[model samples]
Target chain A: MLLVLAVGPSGPSSRSEGVLVRDNNRSHNVRVTDQVQSSKVPVTVLTGFLGSGKTTLLNRILNEEHGMRIAVIENEFGEIGIDDALVIDAQEEIFEMNNGCICCTVRGDLIRILGNLMSRRDRFDRIVIETTGLADPAPVAQTFFVDERVRDELDLDAIVTLVDARHIVWHLDDERPEEVENEAIEQLAFADRIVLNKTDLVSADELEHVVQRIRSINALAEILPATYADVDLVEILDVGAFDLGRVLETDPMFLEDLDHQHDQSVTSVGLEIAGEVDEGRLNRWMSWLLANQGVDIFRMKGILAMEGVSDRVVFQGVHMLLDVETDRPWGAGEERINRLVFIGRNLDREALREQFSSCLVEAV
Target chain B: MSGLHVARIACRAEPLAELGDRIASVAWASDGSALAAGSLSGQVVISDPTDGAVIELAAHELGALTVAWSPDRRLASGGQDGIVRIVDRTGEALAEHKGSGWCESLAWAPGGGGCLGAAVGAQVILWHDGGQLETHDAPSTVASVAWSVDGRRLGAAAYGGILWFERGRAAPVSAFEWKGSLLALSVSPSGKLVAVGTQEGSVRVHRLWTGDDLEMSGYTGRITELAWNSSGDVLSVGDADSVTSWTFRGRGPAGSRPDVLGGHGGRVLSLACAPSGRGAERIITGCADGRLRLYSGTDRSAPLAEIDVGAAVASLAWSPTGDSVAFGDAEGRLWLAEVAP
Candidate 1:
């Protein structure tokens, strides 16, 4: 295989060592160009279900001697008040835009709170918002883009979703009413980092089952197993999962689809192909796909080899908004390859692959 | 072609005072003698617009969010500290009211009444002469508070709707129900209608007593700036870059087209209409691009004059006499400009 992608339960066993093999070898192949503007403040959104140890992780992030001055925004007043950490209680208010798109909603309270937080920008180096257990993460993520001031001044560093290894499966399988969303699945689908906390409570077999279940829905997120939410802070913070300049650092093996029994559930479809894509054809296909199934697509990210183009095209999207930028030129004699991943509900892998394949350049 | 052209309205602006941080709000006294400005660093300063002499008032601890000058020269300020302080023109603190959440909005009753409405979290407290008269609760945190031209009714805007209350009453006499969050509110001078900028980047107006609602949509960003002309015939709304003023003279702005004003390179942060008799149809807007422009109601294509303040304009207000405009920028600098035909 020209591309090395880890799929199914065969991923590196070193994932439990609290160190990323990719990070150690990052200097070899991955050229991470830090193109994010330095002036913008980075915000990490922490979300999980009940009993997921979200509060424990938040406390660790706050009280740990990380040498970073961080402000915390929470749903209710908690006892996490520590030294110099500005804690603000915000009421989660979801506001739907008047433009009539149902998916184009944002958190109204965050817009107000973040605008006020900007005035005291000199006091803190970063910010973290902890959402309620049952809260949907869409509105929170959308607020950073909907509000002008918040979009201009704040950068969404990453969405760190904590999973209770023993209880997450039950929560993910809970029967939801018609038109009701399973927030647990949504959280996993949208996460940039998955902290599988409380691993000591589940057996090895049970933990493997849970990890497999999670992979059936989301494949791009790097999962770290921990007990009592004791994962290293460096893995979650400053991840740059949403930064246009540096993204798609997932282990390529995760891009291979493992055919699990999925009945209209949230699933991830990853495509790895060897060839350059025609820019015009790729754009047409992407626009058509987004327009047709954007509401069902939670997140999409990829790096493409454009035909006759020296630089690689890095793109990512949340719902209907797609962001694309030109990266550094492909390394000399580097294998020309294109990789794409989609995490969403009711995704048809075959149709998506066919549509994408039609955009590839023909072999001469 | 009717009023002053973009080049004809000449004006000179001078720095009045400088605070420690970003200026949040600025208000001019009714007599145009003194200007009060509040900064996000909790500093409040009262400056003599003529000689630029400034008096430093007490700080608000957290950050001052709003400052309003009453007709009797009493300056009322509120801040993130949840304290509403009423100070006389000499910087004497007459009363201090504390609540549980940030006090972001403050309004004094017009027509010489001393009743001041302060929004401290979900409750709107009507304070009079060192005492709390009544506290009205809303469905959510109050975004703005405005007084009717006659001072008979008070309008408090929250997430669900606008609550209208009479003085000394614990319950709201009436309310205008809406679906989304209201960011800013402005009641027409005729006291017959209320206009609100919503979190959804749209402007909604409700006719008092009739409950007839009008919505103007398609703004580029959240509508945080709304102002009404003296005659109550025009309602100007600010967005990310442009200002659209709707005519409310006829059966309302229902079917009438609005006059769109552009040329500001950045977001419009503050807007104020001139007082009734003197500069009646004129409106001044301060933008994030650090420019202030004067626009006549008759012509919306271009501004009457553009003055660069060199920083994001946080707040601006017109003097009661309508001859002077006071504005504060993000750099904590307060400026007073004299406008002439």
Candidate 2:
């Protein structure tokens, strides 16, 4: 069964007009705009836990006659090296990603490899990186933002993570090291789109439970159910999931029934508070919070009503870096409710809530 | 005085098969018969300047960070993919070494020692054309690696200090401790002084015997270049702007003010000291803004000649006789200049 769920582009206008390689010129045409996006290529990252149907989705995307030439970067664990044998042949191009973890030791390697690929823009239209199983997607996603050359030559589209419906609980329940939490949970927490694959393997009741569990962990990203990784091409391509303007897309009532209780330390913290938060205090609080405990907190997004400000302040963060921006302004007589959601490991909910509440301005 | 003088040379350009792939590093054969260039695109090529024939090979599919030529003319390259390859001039893979991370640096023992050393991940492996000869581990990723002229000792520089490994020893012979990240290393021809450029814009000269090390400051950014003049009494360094040479005569560069040489609009990207053990020592520097300058004298204060290769210089190398020099730029072009006495 191929279940296709439609997830709309979060913020189309926010997508930087990726400095497009015009044609067969093969020469870099520089544009004057945001220094990062002027001459960059679009890169999509697909990640998930082992047996999560990522390869299946990749194969499907490659096989489709979408008219777009895509380059696939496959990363397999070095010692085992099973990906080479499971290699899929497609009409498009495929290459190996850097060897070590993209975040730490092999960062330089990724810069070189990506810079090299950008130099040869005639071959591939877009780039998709399929990370190794049991890999954290944050580092892969961060590569574009961290490296000046990569950022200047690559636009990050989104991080799409596939979930194994039948064994989602089992993988998430696996114990993790102290500094490093469960990779399975991190995959889900970091995704812009969560594909609940292998749904047929579970009963209807089990599928419902899995969806609920996933929502409890990450209610911001769109959740789609699928079988054998079958999904529509439009749902995956050109989606501006990383746009900061529309990042805080949670519905006001989505967490109404969210009485989350489990044996795990990892979960989402959602808050809807009234009154405006002082802009200065909010910045200080966020800067301090992220600086101190950013590693423990995986992902966070919020829409805040700042004191004396007509526009809503949108904030999103991954690890230590936070992206803050002003989004659409408030309408006439609209209820200015602030909403925030944090997905992390072993979070002190009360401590965070109290600190957040301190930033609020009192109502007359 | 500007402490800078401008001159030009009759330099010739010989490009590779492809352009725009920035040359990452360059090296010359021990006998000056061949020149090997590694690019940011992972393509490595060995060229003959005499006849203009080029042998191109995909030495690394990603890119290579460093490359060197042994005494026997075999080229050893360390790449971004963490693979260290030793290949002949004809593109034959003589030997290959794999580390857990990117192979960031490579060096060959001077003289006929035939020792090749590479830094990959947190370990440094000293090998030849055959197999692993010796291995040493560091507390952090090694930024640079070098060997004594006689190939009797190996020095791997990392964050805390520079670890010295003796031949056939499983443990380090000694360590020159510094509290910063060492980005470049240059062991003098006499193997008496081990100079290091650090993450901070400074240079450190560590005397092997006395354990007395000196730190020279005043550069603006991280030091990317280090070299020793012919007599080993003068050490020249570049940290993006001006090139400086310190007097290493008596107490060995300790508490000595250095003589700053030349400056460029861009940072000094790479440095190559004269490789010929028998000639008058000179210093060559390549800058980020596409300028290459050569300086003469024990303090390297006299400017000899320079050329604007029209691209950011990525790497440079000197021939054995100090009569010729080869350099590669970020625009993927290689050039050779003849320095007439």
Candidate 3:
């Protein structure tokens, strides 16, 4: 039997008003933002472990008369096929950069396939890439950050990881050969939203265990439990999960609500403070931290309150590639605060909090 | 001083025929009598440059990714549907073969026995006289393939590197190791050197039959537009906006400066070197800014001539005779230009 789950969009707002602040290379800002208009296609990456029901969700997305032409790029040829969707098969080809930058690997196949799809842009409204079970989701996410052509033409909407609630613990604890990674843990750590499927098979207490395990690794992801992948279309499609403008919509209590921990090495660290940060000090700290320990940092996102700046500085990163942008101005009477989250392995929570506090405005 | 100068040589471009869909690949016939263009909407057309005539064929229902001319005068086209077809100039299908996935790369061997090499998915299929000559599975999906000048060896570029194979061999005879993805591959006319445009914004050149390899990095973006001059002494590379030519002489391109041809306002999408034996060597660059610029390979600062093509150029080819050039654009237009001293 196949099972799937769904995630819903937090809220809808005009995503067009955000200003992207590209720090690594200033020139990319001019060209990337120039084409960020409505014509830019949104791509959703769906990843899960084996028996996680990604294909079932894909079939639902294609068969529905949603009035959008969707192109589905599947890593494996599933057992069932749908008639209407423009399905393209992809081989999982991970490409490492020659520059020797750690964690800079990307999915080379997506770069080639996406280039071909962009040529017939009129034939499809959006694209969905369903990664194979046991695939590392980081390379798929990093493709958006590394390739110039893909970065300019397509917007990475979100990474939705489907979880097999009944059998996830077994896979999570499976021992691997020394250098190989546990893909299940990495999937959860990199996810923007996670679908906890097969809820019906587990009791309330068992379901709670699975949810706690997921939250231990990724506290920011919205976990939606379902059966047979019966996810609402609106919640999963075009969520703008990567848009810096949506950073304000996150729940303020998620950072403080993490009360449990898992034995697995991967975990989440959240920092919430009520003060503005010194711009120069924050830049220095962020660059230094990412350069030194970016290999273990799977994903990070934060909405910072900069000193003397009225707008919120929002940033999100996959490994070392970070994209920062200034979001909407703070609403009148809104208390200024900073919220940040880091999901990865071997994170020292106290050290991060201390370093982050040092960058805060010093008791004015 | 801006250190940039503009020079004008006698050159003019005109629309030859429009295919009504985005042209994916363009190639000139071996005799320079016709031009073949494949469109993303699955339309293939053979056009006469001298006259405004066209013969259109529904070659690939899904879309055509590549088109090349066999030395025996047949036009071979491959498409997203994983089918390869060979057709005559009159638009009649002479032969057809099906592969596993999207057939993106096609190259006809130079010795003229009607041999063709194609990269279809992760497998390399060699076709001769309407039959499969040999097939070899690559380590990963094959991105590009090329044939040696003597037609004795074929090089297939994938994730690992270029795998060299001889005819009728089930396994690769040798390989060049590059631990990155190769986007484009080119074998020199002398058949002694191989060059590949990598996914990491660099050009890697390997000396055939030897382990000598060199890398040229620091390009503005991934190096996809690559070309080898007729004599194989020059390799022209294109990235985000500018084109650079590296001369492979003496001990090769090591420790030498490249001549930067900087003028395009957008990414250089295509590059083609003029045929050899001509009096002067020239290379043409088609850019995303909808312009074509021609430059003498030896010059660093200026283009010989340029014209606005009104769309992002997708494919470019210099005719065998070396006096004319044909380029296709994103707007499904095939253009022919006359290049003169």
What is candidate 2's lDDT per residue for A176-226, written digit by digit as tens? 776666878888888878888998899999999998888877767788889
Give the lDDT of residue A303 in candidate 3. 85
Model 3 agreement with the true structure over B1-341: per-residue lDDT tens digits: 01122233233344677776678899988889888999887888889888868888766866788999887678999988888888888888888888787888999998667788999888998887757557788988888999988887888988878998888878898888778888899988877888898887778888777847778877756777888888888888887778877888895466667778877888888988888766347888888888878887566476767877678888888888888778888888888777763
The local distance difference test score of model 3 is 0.78
Q: Fnat of candidate 2, please? A: 0.00
lDDT of 3 at B307: 77
Better of 1 and 3 by DockQ: 3
lDDT by residue (A1-364, candidate 1, tens digit) is: 0111111111111222111112322111112223446678899999997788988888898889878888899877632335767787777777776343545677877887788878652557889999977888888887775565787789899999999999999999999997899999999999989999999999999999999999888888889999999999999999999886675777454557478444579988888888888766776666667767888899888888888878777877677655566677889989878888889987887787888888888832
Tens digit of per-residue lDDT, candidate 1, span B1-341: 12334344434444788787788999888888898999987899999878778999989875788999988999999987789999899999888888867798999998766899889888888987658567777778898999877888888898888988897677898888777788898989888878898876677888776877778776756788999888887888887778888877756466566677768888898999888886688889989888888887677788877877778877999888887788888888887776653
Measured on C-alpha atoms, candidate 1 has an lDDT of 0.79
Candidate 1 chain B: worst-modelled 10 consecutive residues by lDDT: B1-10
Q: What is the C-alpha lDDT profile of model 2 across B4-23, one tens digit per residue? A: 33223457644533434777
lDDT of 2: 0.68
- Clashes per prediction? 3, 4, 1
Per the 3 Å backbone cut-off, how many clashing residue pairs does candidate 2 have?
4
- Candidate 1 DockQ category? incorrect
